[model samples]
Structures are given as structure tokens and as C-alpha cells.
Target chain A: MDEINLQRQSSTNDELVLIEEFFAQLTKPKNLDSIRDKAREFCQRNSHLKIALVTSGGTTIPIELNTVRFVDNFSAGTRGSASTEYLLKTEQYAVIFLFRHKSLEPFWRHFSSDELFSHLDVNPETNQVTVCPSFQPKLKEVISEQKKSENRLLKITFTTLSEYLFTLRELTMVLNELGSKAMLYLAAAVSDFYIPPENLAIHKIQSSEPLRLHFELVPKVLRPLVKFWVPDAFVISFKLETDENILLLKARNALKRYGHKLVIANELNTRKHKVTLVTEIDSESIQINSQNDEIEIEQLIVANVVERHNQFIHDQSSR
Target chain B: MDEINLQRQSSTNDELVLIEEFFAQLTKPKNLDSIRDKAREFCQRNSHLKIALVTSGGTTIPIELNTVRFVDNFSAGTRGSASTEYLLKTEQYAVIFLFRHKSLEPFWRHFSSDELFSHLDVNPETNQVTVCPSFQPKLKEVISEQKKSENRLLKITFTTLSEYLFTLRELTMVLNELGSKAMLYLAAAVSDFYIPPENLAIHKIQSSEPLRLHFELVPKVLRPLVKFWVPDAFVISFKLETDENILLLKARNALKRYGHKLVIANELNTRKHKVTLVTEIDSESIQINSQNDEIEIEQLIVANVVERHNQFIHDQSSR
Candidate 1:
């Protein structure tokens, strides 16, 4: 047991070194300071309201320094965006939405180019544009809700994996001031491997030759996030898998390693309809009534998470 | 010279086998039949108008069969969309725009989400939504142009490399009936390499180990496109390079290899402001006069291309 402990310590030390090198080589995002300021102001302004740092969409790993090519994780930000809308509806939480640029946004996801254009009417003589009568009610509701949540919602966009990590760290540190009232709902599909800056090509990779690539594991930031950054916050991380057999086991392992409050375990194909919430003590599955139902699974997921977060806050205060 | 000829013949034979295998493994795009029918109907209806197939945006290469991860090329469809609008302005051309899903569209590119919403006003009393007066003129112009070109323009969308290629072939064959009047404007930033379906992982690739990937060169579809599919069509291919020194040489090489009508060569950094048009006998560079010029380079590029196309038709008729 002692030998095993020593080996684990050595592995952790190596990881620390890797993380340090990773950050050292990364160029800080250009809008880091402004985003940090926005997040700080949001947290301070909503001191009474519970703050949720809801990360959405997928992060990209560039194969070239000039970034003509990149490896991307597949996510439309559906879960994160839908969950944000639900959380805002509860009136108890202020959200910092750190999302991928051009991915779906909360209320905006309902309108596609065709849907928006099809419902618009143009009065050529008056030089006016109006939403058709049938679409006005839905548009008005979305617009009003958007206005109500304007002050409570802070949006910060990131494109690359490095940018995402840098912003996530900065925001997490800022939210630490909130103590037990903060929640980290990490739903972004971050790339697990990346070609580091030094190894990336300076220009476009030519098509003249067959391509070979080697990528190193992206340093696991969740460890430092949970253990050091904001241990008092109610942390929730997501586990998405293609195979059902390993989904719960992976979620349980993540909980053991990170010591986070909950793991939202989901299979890729059925994720939109069902999810399993795995806490330290037990796991519970949540599913929509029917596949054809109009309800989003995020509606149920956010409610359950909110209840658990409330319990965590209450437990802390009692202790 | 004999030895070189033998080697070239062998290489060509190998490439043919690879192309055959590639298509054999690819699944046909689901909407291929509908898109083909649309293209055919447009061609038959507008037989007198010249047809231009303008491909835009970038194709993605899936790393796994389930496609949780992908390698993507960087393209915004700016050049293609802008060029299409300019082509339509000529009034003598009809465009079949084959584009990446969710990339910029011809007239719709002018307005972003924030731009669109900021100009919108909600009226709760009458249950109405209207565009603000200040933004009315621009909206009117875009909407009018969109309506005018509704019959002349056909839009088709693809996301993955296989889908792009399959649809491209099907569309090219359908456009073949138009003969020399058909102009192929190939501008899409297609991936140079891809992981074959047989070699791709069936599930999500585990993150426990460092990733090593080998990608085969995507077969040169341009050869078969020019030589077999649409030999009589006036084809214009684009060559993009980061290195200025190799740009023209590569463009010339492509013309010689594919026997296409023209090659539009552009350096990666200066593409927005300048491009060189390369034909069999000579090359000409076109550039916007000033950095702050409101005119898009695509306008100039399309005008020059149309002039050459006109001369080609005249020469053909004379022959």
C-alpha cells in the first residue's frame, strides 16, 4: 500500500510538471481580462443569487500554428444551452455562459435561418419588416425572457482548447469568492488530446504527402479545479460515452478522483432523452416520458442539480 | 523519359484504384436524389442562361465511425457566397451553390445574430414585432435581392468530406447535360487527408493513452472530374498556399495535371484583397486598390472570370 501511494505521488508530480509546461507554452487569449472582469462583476452583482458557471459546446485543437486545420469534438451545445434557459427560469441562479462561438445559444436555438426568414414580412413601400402574426407570440416570449435574463447572464466565447482552459481557470478563480453558492456545471465537450504549440506546423499541411500525427493527452484540469480552486462549490461534471457498460463506472471513477458533488452520465445516442445522475452514494436514472415528447431532458437535469446544490449549501451551513 | 512515363502511368493506375475504393466505402448522401432533381429542373428551365456551380466552405473528416471527433478545414464561405451574389448581378448566369451546412449564405451573410436582434423591436400592445427604422433600408435591399434570385439560385448543403464528394460527383454529372455552358467554380476547402471508414474506430476513442493517427491522401477527384465527368465544361479550380513562392508553380502544375480552363491562385494571408488568375498561356493578378476599400475582391474576381468565359464561348462558336 505504501509503495502504491509513492507511485501515485510520482505520477501526480509528473502531471503537475506537464500542466505547468502546457500553460507556459500557451498564448493567453486576447479577451481574457475583459471576460474576467465581466465574470467578476456578474458574481458581485448577484451576491444573493446562486451563480452557475455553465460551459457549453466543444473545444477545438489546432493542428497548425496558423490554424488552417483543427480537430474538433462534436457538440451543438444543446444540453448546456437548454439547461441555461431552465436555470434562468428558476429565478434563483445567475449564469456565466462560457460557450463555443457560433454554437447554439439559449433562446436563439429555436430560430434557424429558414424558420426566421419564412415568418418575416416585408412592406416595401414603408421600408419595414415585421414578424408574421403566427410567429409573434413565440418571438415575444423569447425576447421578453431574453431581456429579463440580460443582467443575470454573462457570455464569454472561446474557439480553441487553450482558450477554453485559460478562460475556465480565470472564471473559476473569480467564482471562488462566492464560496458555497457557486456551481460549476461543466458540460463542454473538451478535446482529450492535442498537438502542443511547439509541435504544430507553421503553415498549412501540404497535401503532397500522407499525413501522420501524434497528440499528447491534454492535462486534466478538473483535479486542480476541484481540490484547489473552489472546493466548497457544488461541482458537476459530465461523462459522455458511446458504450453503456462503461458509462457508470467512468462516472464513479471521476467522482472518486475529483471529489465533485455529482456526475451526469450519458450515452451519446440517448443523451438527449435520458441521463444518469451519479453521486457518491448512489446513481439515479432520469428519462423523458416518451421519445416523441416535447419536453427536453435538460429541464429535468437542471432541476435535480439545483436540488442537490441546495442540499449541499444547507449541509455546509449546518456543519 | 521512357522510365518517367512508365512510372507516371503506374502512379495514375494506383490513383484510379484508390478513387474506386474510396467511393465504394462511402455512403451516398441521403438528400442526393432531391438535390440532383433540383439541379436538373433548374438547368432545364434556364437553358439559355449560363450555369455556374459554386462550391464553398470546408469539409470535415470524421475520425470515428460514430463521428464524436473530426478534423476540420478552415473556411467561412466568404469568397464563394460573395462571388455568387456578384455572378447573379450579371443577369446572364444561374448558380447552383454547393456549400457547407451553417456557413454563410449569399444574401444572408450581411446580418449576424446581434445585428438582427438589435434592429428588432417588440410591441406588446398589438402583439407585433418590427425592424427599427434605421436598419430598414439595408434589410429591404437584401430581402429584395433574395426574392429576385430565388428562381435562379439553388442551395445544397454538406458537412462531411464523403458527403461533399458524393454530392459533388452527382451534381457534376447532372450539370453535364448543359455541356460547355456550365462553369465549375470549385472553391471549397476540401480536406487533404482522411481516415478510411474501415480503419476508423467504432466508438469514442478512449483518452487513457496518447493518440497516434495515420491518414491516407484523399484521391485527386479533380482528375476524374475534368477528364471523365464533364470534359466540355469550363472549369475554374482554386489553389491556396501559405508560401508565396510555391503558389503560382502549384497553380500551373494543377492546370497541367487536370487540364482545366483556369486556376485562381491566392496566398492565405492576402486572399481577401488579391488573387491571381492563371490560364494556359498567361497569369494576371487582381487586387483591391486600397486596404479600406468597401468593395469585395470577389466582385472583381467574378467580373474577370465572366469576361474570360464570354471570350471562351465566342471562340468555341467560331470553331
Candidate 2:
């Protein structure tokens, strides 16, 4: 009975309703065609390389159409960006990074805007500034690697939940043409509830009275995404919960329902320190502790994922 | 009867209750005492100069104690930041900027992270990057001016509404010692509603079910601030409304209720384009459009405000 209910929930018409409403509300992102063209050209040029579609940061749900206020999930794009750096180090894949506006990004994520300034010294005489000596090694590595992969990496930003969903679907469809050569990492903290276009207030919400906000469940885009859009590609989804007891259960359920390749489960507080990788065959907890804390956990997570990805490619080619 | 009711509301036990509750919930900011000491030192060393306390950006109200999600107002700190730059250019006043973390800051706000990178080139042979020639003149001017005023400027950041209120009260108490020489610019778009500490969930709110959030009204800190904290100092508050018709009315009401020196009235859509400066004696609309669009409205607003501040000081001294 439980399985039947879960199956029913996955196939519900609610998803179709959501997709329709979402499309109706979208204002076709201005650079959509240009981004699509660039991605196609990059893929064609780097045909021998494995390609990654990494979605980072959190998507926001505007409380009002004019958006004086918003409902925001807590994601700084640390995991996705750090993982991208690790993936790039392997030199095996071209990356298409779809991220939330103002969130962290690859390489640059390691330094804040203030820190960037502190690492440069103004030459008062020449009226110019250059990178300070101590930081030269790291900055040089980043610049060189970035130059090498400039043609292979594309970054696009989305702010609202609707924009993210539309872009995600479009990007996945384009990448699907590559078959098993494509990999999708859905790391963005997407909102579970949203005020549909028809229900959203047209102006900034008034604060004169007690504000009562009503949110509807966002349609499960993962269903259509896994079953139809990019069925051949390896997909990984994230499951974040505050309660430890329910974390694994929710993650397993998501894996079973969505039929995705893996689910990364984590507790909100300890997310940076630990994460559990759940797959059909096994569940593994990855941790960064006092001794190994010097190393970022994403480095380990990405290495393990790359190994599995290589295995997947070999198996597909052999078959 | 209306005046009596307004007075009663201002001194209602509700405000006291809210203050007590707010303090009880606050975790002393890590650098509170150090920041206070620095401000005191700055004030003493620069006793001859005027000092402005500018609060910018928007404060967040976390939905859960663990805070995986939050309710946030959309303010990029443009007005406060731009105004600060203008005030600094006068070289007459020292500034203490209390702003939302990661929001735009005074001089640096003018450049985006991407733009900063675009203005630099990395030499492969030397493995060092330098600012491109075209951008050097502007960068030099900004750097020199910033260096000249570094000692007179202090910046502190706050993220949560509780932190902002606590810091505001603490800073105001310190500044009150300066008496008529101090000015307060409350430009932050603080949250009107928040999930109080006692009512907040200990964990991230579960999204499996429909989310129903309950929020309590945030006490009007401006009342106690103007009435007791810094009664002798010039206080300017902002009134932002979506409806243009209500904008000036709300600003006037606020001025009467709080007895603040001035109120800046603005409609949401036209906030950047125009604003009405409201005072007890008069109101005036300041705008930048077809002819003066090249000029930032903050420049004009800051100039007018500085002129009034000068007149206020002269008037007080004569009395």
C-alpha cells in the first residue's frame, strides 16, 4: 500500500499543472537562446570530453510580483562550487554551471570580495595594484587553470524559483542529446512551496496589517526530469533535513520514487562536516573531522563520484 | 483622542515586553565590546568632526532556529552606500556604517565581482595580473580617496533582525554622548514580522507538509531610539510604500509619531528615480530624469541633507 501510494504521488497530474503554470508565468530569460547556442558549440568542440551540468545555490520564491520581499533557502553555493573545482582538476569534463545570482562560484568561492582586495597592494607611485607575493601561487594556479578551461566552462545565473526550473529543464534537454556522456548534478536548494503567478500580489506586499502568506506545493519536476527529459544521463539529487532520524529515510524514499542514480543526504547543522551518499547498492557516510578537516569534504565526494562515473561510462560502452 | 492614542501606543507595555524578549533572545555579538571601544576611540580622536551613523541593507528573519530558510526583504543597500560615498567626499564627517552582511558597501559597491575581474589581465610569463589601463584612472581615484578616509570610516555587518536591533540600540547609546554632533540615518529595510525565539522551531522546518508560518510583529525600535536613546541627535527615517498616494502621508505620520527630525518618503518603483524629503515645516520632491539622469539622486540628496545638517549645528550652537 505504501509503495502504491508513493507511485501514485509520483504520477499525479499536479506536476503537469505546475509545469503549465510555470511556463505561463515565465518571461523567457533574455539570454536563453545565446546560452543554448554557446552550450551547443562548446559540446560540439569538446566532443571527446565528458560534460557536467552543475546547478548551485538556492532558488528564491518571490512573495510579491514586484518582489520587495522573498522566501529564501539557506545555501551559499559552497558545496556545488567546491565540487566543481575538484571536477575541473581531473581535466576529464567540460562544465556548464547554472547557479543562483550572487551565490559563490568556482575558484572565486575561496575568496571573499574584501579578501580579494587585501591580497593586492596599490603601487602609489604608478597608481596601479598587483597581487601580493604571498597569494601569487594560488592566484596563478586559478588563473592558469581557468585560461585552459575557458572554452569548456559556461556559467548562467538564475534568481527566482521559476527561472531556475525553466533553465534546468532546458539545459537538461539540450545536454540529453549527448546520451550517457552527460552528467547532471542538481545541487541547488530549490523551494518546496511557491505562490503561483495568479496568486502572487502584483505590487510590494503591504505591512500595514498582519501579513498572511499562502504557499502551494511546487510540482515535483524530478519526476518528469528523471523519467523523460534526461533518462540516459547519470543524475544526483540532494536531500537536506534538520532531523537526523528522518534524513536517511527521506533520502531513500526520494531515490526510490525518482529513480535517480544517487541521493546525497545531510543534516542541516552538520552539512559542512558530514554527508551520506545513498545509492541502490549501498549507503556511505563521508566525514571531515579534526585530523582531515584541512581537506574539503567536496574534494573527497567529487573523487568518489568521478570514480563511479568512470565505471558507468565503461559499463555503457561495453554493453 | 487620536493624539492620546498615538502617545499611548508609543509608550505601551507591548514595546517594553518586546524589548525584554528581544534582549533575552540575543546572543551577544562576538565583537560587540571591541566594536564599541573602537567607536568610542574614533569619536574621542575626532571630536572636532561631525559623525554620521548610517544603517543600510535589509535584515533577515529566520524561519527556524537552525535556519535553513529565512524571510528576507529585498534591499541592496544602494541608497545608504551611495549616500555614504557622497558624505565622505565632503571630508567633513566621520562615518560608522552598520550594514547587512554581504550587501553593497560604500566605494566597493560601485563595482561588481565580475567587473573587477574583467578589469584585470594575467600575464602568463610573469604569472601576475594587473589592472587594465582603461580602468586604472577610476581605480586609482577610488583607492586614493579610500586610503585618505580609511581612519575616519568604520564598517560593521549584521545579518539577523535581532542582531541589528541590539547593535542599533548599543551604538545609539554610545553616540548619544556626542549629543548634537551625531546623526542617525536609518535606511535599512528591517523586517516587520519575525518568528520569535520562543516560537521558532529548533530544526529546519519540514517541507513535506504544507508550510504554515506564524510571525509576530517586530516592535518599533525607532520610537525608543528617537525618544530616549539619541534624543539630541538628528534622526532621519525612511518611509517606503508601494502606493504613491500613501507615501507622503505615511512619512508625515511617522515624523509626528516618532518626533524624528526628517522622513524620506519614496514609492517602491520610483524609489531610485525620485523621493520626497519630508520635514515638520515642509516637503519637497527631488528627482533625476531626462536632463540630470547622469547624476545620481544620492548626490543631490546628500548635498541637501549636508546643508540642513550644517544649518542645524549652527542653530543649536547659537541657542
Candidate 3:
């Protein structure tokens, strides 16, 4: 048993070295400083509230340096955005939302293009445009809620895998100042493989030839994120899978490997309606009631997460 | 020369067979019938006006059967959507817009999320939502143009390469009834390669393994599109390249091989401000003047195209 533990530790050290090399090769995002400044300002203004870093959407992997082509993961950012809205409603937490550019956002998700366009009325004579009567009440409520939370919410957008990882590291290091008061809610579907920059084509690939692509495994950064970046912060990672049988197993393995506080496991088909919260000792499933369709599963998931987080803070204080 | 001609004809026949097989293996989009119906209605209502089928945006290549990952070509549909708006302004043309889902659309392209959100005002007392005074004029103009052109424009959306090709074929066959009065503006950034259904994974690809992808060249349907489907229609294809030296060469090659009327060539870096219209006899470069910053280059390109299309129609009628 001791020998096995020693071998695992050595492997983790090698992985950490690879992760460091990955960052060294990547060009840091230009807006990273702005993101850090916004986070610092939020922390200073809402000193009494716990800070939650919520990551949403999927990171893209560019196939070439010029990047006329890219591999994109499927995510509309529904879970992360909805969770942020619910967490903000608790009033105990302020959120820094790191999301993919142009993905669904917190209050804005309610108004899709079709819904918004259909509900708009234009008066040609007066040159006036008005939101239709039926949509006004809902629009008013969302706008008011959005205005109220404006001070507490900080949004930072990223597109590529390198941008997402670099921003994640930068934001977490800044939030580490809060110690146990900070929470990391990582929900972005990050790429697991990427074509190294050295191997990427600099020009648009011609269509006359057959194409072959080779991708190396992307170095796992979650291990360093939990163990080094914010050791004192409560971390909750999400695992999404198309296969239900391996879902909980993978979630448990992630928690055991990373030593994070919790793992939320969801399957692709039933993700909106059901999820399992897995920890070191046991797992609990959270499902929305089929009879009441009005409630979002994120609302229930956020409530449960807040309760557990409160208990964690209490235990830490006592210790 | 006769032998070479025979060899080229045989290869094209083989390619047409492959294209037919490619479509057979794919599942048809559920909304295809509605798209067909919409095209029929537009044609019936606007019999007096010349018809144009304008394709925009980029098509995606799914990496798996269930499609959690896809390789996407880069296009914001700027040229296509802008061209559609200009074509409608002529009042001589009714357009059937076939575009990628969620890409920029005609008129709506002017209002991005930030622009729309910042220009909105909510009245607290009456729960009234109104467009701000500063934005009302532009909003009113766009809304009124949108309403006026509703009857003349038919909008159809597609996502994957399969959907785009299928819809393109269906719409062209329907528009063929108009003969020389119809124009085909093929502007979409379509995929050059794809993974056939037989080679695709059944579920989400696991991250634990190194990914190796093999792609076959997508069969060129342009040959059959011109020779068989709507052979009498005026066809204009686009060639986009990163290398400037090869741009005009490739554009001319496309016209010679496909026997199309024109090829619009543009480099990736200079696409927005400049483009070259390549025909069998000559090539002309249309550039936006530095002095005039207000006019879109699409307006100039559309004017040139309309003039050529009118000449072609006049020639056919005289024949």
C-alpha cells in the first residue's frame, strides 16, 4: 500500500511539470488584468459576502495557428448561468462569472432571439419601439433583478482552451486572498486534447489533400488548482458524461485524486432534471419533481450546495 | 484532348455517386419540409421579381454520431447577411436566405447583445419597457425595413454540412422554375473535409485516450449543381484563402471547372474591405475607398453582380 502511494505521488509530480510547461507555451489573454482588477474590486466592495468563481460554457481547440478551423465542445452554458443567478439570490455570495464569449448569460438567457423579436412592436408614425404588453412583466422582473445584482456580478469571457486555463489560474490566485470564504464552481467543458502550437499550420489548410490530425492529451490542471492555487477554498467540480454507468465512478475518482470538497456528476440526457453530488464517503442524487415543471433543477442544486457550504464554514471556524 | 475530356467526365460521375451515398447515410433534418414550403410560397407571391438564393455562415462537421464535438469553419456571415440586406434594397429581387443558425442575420446584425441591452430603458412606475431615445431612430428604421421586406424574404437555417447541402439542393430545384431570372449566390464557408457516418463514434469521445482523426475530402457538389440542378440560373461562388498569391488563381480555376458565371475571391485578412470578381473573360477588383468610411463593400459588390445578372438575363431572352 505504501509503495502504491509513492508511485501515485511521483506520477502527480510529472503531471504538475507538464501543466507548468503548458502555461509557459500559451500566450496570456490580453484582458486578464482587467478581470483581476474587477475581481479585486468586487472582493473589496462585498467584503462580507463569500466569493464564488463560476465557470461556464465550453473551451474551443483551434486546429491551426491562423485558426480558420476549430473543434468546439457542446455547451450552451445553461447550467452555469442558472446556477449563478440562484447563488446571487442567496445574497450570501458574490460571483465572478468566467464564461465562453456569446454563450447564454444569467438574466439574458430568458430572452432568446425568437422570443425577443416576436414580442417587439414598432410604431412607424411615432418612430417608437416598445416591448409588447405580455412580455413587459417578465422583462421588468428580470431587468430589476439584473440591476440589483450588477454590483456583485463580474463577467469575464474566454474563447480558446489556453485562454480559459490562463484566466482560471489568474482569477483563482487573486481570490485566494479570501481563504475559506471563497468557493470554486468549475462547470466549463474544457478540451481534453489539443494540437500543440509547434504542430499547428500557419495558413488555411488546402482541401485537395486527405487530412489527418494528431492530438495529445491536455495536461490536467484541476489537481494543481485544488492542491496549490486555493487550498483553503471550498472547491466543487462538475463531471458530465454520455455514459451513465461511468458517470459516478469518474466523479468519485476526480474527488479522490484532486482532494476537492465535492463533485457534481451529470449525464448528457438527464442533466437538466437530475444530478448526483459525490463526495469522499457517499453520494446523493438531486432530482426535480416531475409534477412541478416550473422549478429549475439549478435552484435546488444551489440550495443544497449553499447548505453544505455553510456547514463547511462552520466546521472550519470551530477547528 | 478527347481522351482527357473523357477522363474528367468519368471522374465527375464517380464523384456524383459518392455525393449521393453521403447524403443517403445521413439523417434528414426534420424541418426540411417547412423550408421547402416556405420557398414555394415566396416564389408564388413574388413572381414578378427576380429570385436570389443567398447562403451564409459556416457549416460544421460532427466528429461523433451523437455530436458532443464538431469541427467548425470560421465565418460570422458578415458578407452573406450584408449582401442579403443590399440585395433586398434593390426592390428588383426577392431573396431566400439560407444561413447557419445563430449567425448574424440581415438587419438584426446591427444590434449586438451589448448594443441592445445598453439601449433599453425600464419605467419603474408603469412597468413599461421602451427603446431609449438615442437608439429609437435606428431601431425604428430597421424594424420598419424588416416589416416591409417580410413578404419578399424567406429565411431558412442550417447547422451541419449535411443540412446545408440538403437544403441548398432542395431550394435550388424549387427556384429552377424561374429559369434565367434566378441567381445562386453561394457564399457560405463550407467544410472541405468530413468524417463519414461509418467512421464516427457512437457516443461522446472519452478524454482518457489520445485522439487521432482521419478525414476524407468532401465530394464537390458544385459540378452537379451547375450542370443538373437549375442549369439556367446565374451561379456565383466564393473562394476564400489566406494566401494572397493563390486567391485569384483558385477563383478562376473554380469557374473553369464548375462552368459558373462568376467567382468572388477574397483573402482572409482583407475580406471585409476588398474582393475580386473573377469571370471567364476578365477579373475586376472592388475596393471600398478609404475616403468613404460609411459604405459597406457588400453594397458595391451587389451592384456589380446585379448589373451582370441583368445582362445575362437580357442575352438569354434575345437568344
**Candidate 2 ranges beyond 4 A from true positions:** A1-18, A25-30, A291-293, B1-18, B25-28, B290-293
Best by DockQ: 3
Please provide, for model 3 over A1-319, each residue's C-alpha lDDT reduced to its tens digit, 9 standing for 90 to 100.
Answer: 5999999999878877878888988767888888788788889998999999999999999997878899998899999999999999888999999999988889888887657766777864665888888898888888788878878998889999999999999998888998888988999988889998889998899999889999988877888998888988989999988889889989988988899999999988889899999999999999987667799999998998888888888888899
Candidate 3 per-residue C-alpha lDDT over B75-136 given as tens digits, one digit per residue, 9 for 90 to 100: 99999999999999999999999999988889888787657775776876676887788988
What value of lDDT does candidate 1 attain over all alpha carbons? 0.89
lDDT of 2 by residue, B154-238 (tens): 8989998878987888898789998888989889999988876877898877666677777767767788788778988989999
State the lDDT of candidate 2 residue by residue for A107-198, as single tens digits.
Answer: 77767877766676678676586667787777667766666766778888999887888788888868899888888888999998887777
lDDT of 2: 0.83
Lowest lDDT sum, 10 consecutive residues, model 2 chain A, at A21-30
Tens digit per residue, CA lDDT, model 1, B1-319 = 6999999888878877877777998877888888889889989988889999999999999998877899999898999999999999899899999999988889888887667876776765765677778887888788888878878998899999999999999999888887788899999999999997889999999999999999989988999899878888889999988888999999999999999999999988889998999988999999886566689999999999999888877887788
| Interface DockQ of candidate 3 | 0.72
TM-score, model 1 to reference: 0.95
**Residues A1-319, model 1: lDDT tens digits:** 6999999888878876867787888878888888889888888999889999999999999998877899999999999999999999999999999999988888888787667776766765665776778888888888878878878888889999999999998998898888899999999999999997889999888998899999999877998789777878999999999989999999999999888989999999999888999999999999986656688899999999999999999999999
Proportion of native contacts present in model 2? 0.50
Higher-ranked by lDDT: 1 or 2: 1
Docking class of 3: medium
lDDT of the structure predicted as candidate 3: 0.89
Error of 1 at A251 (Å): 0.8
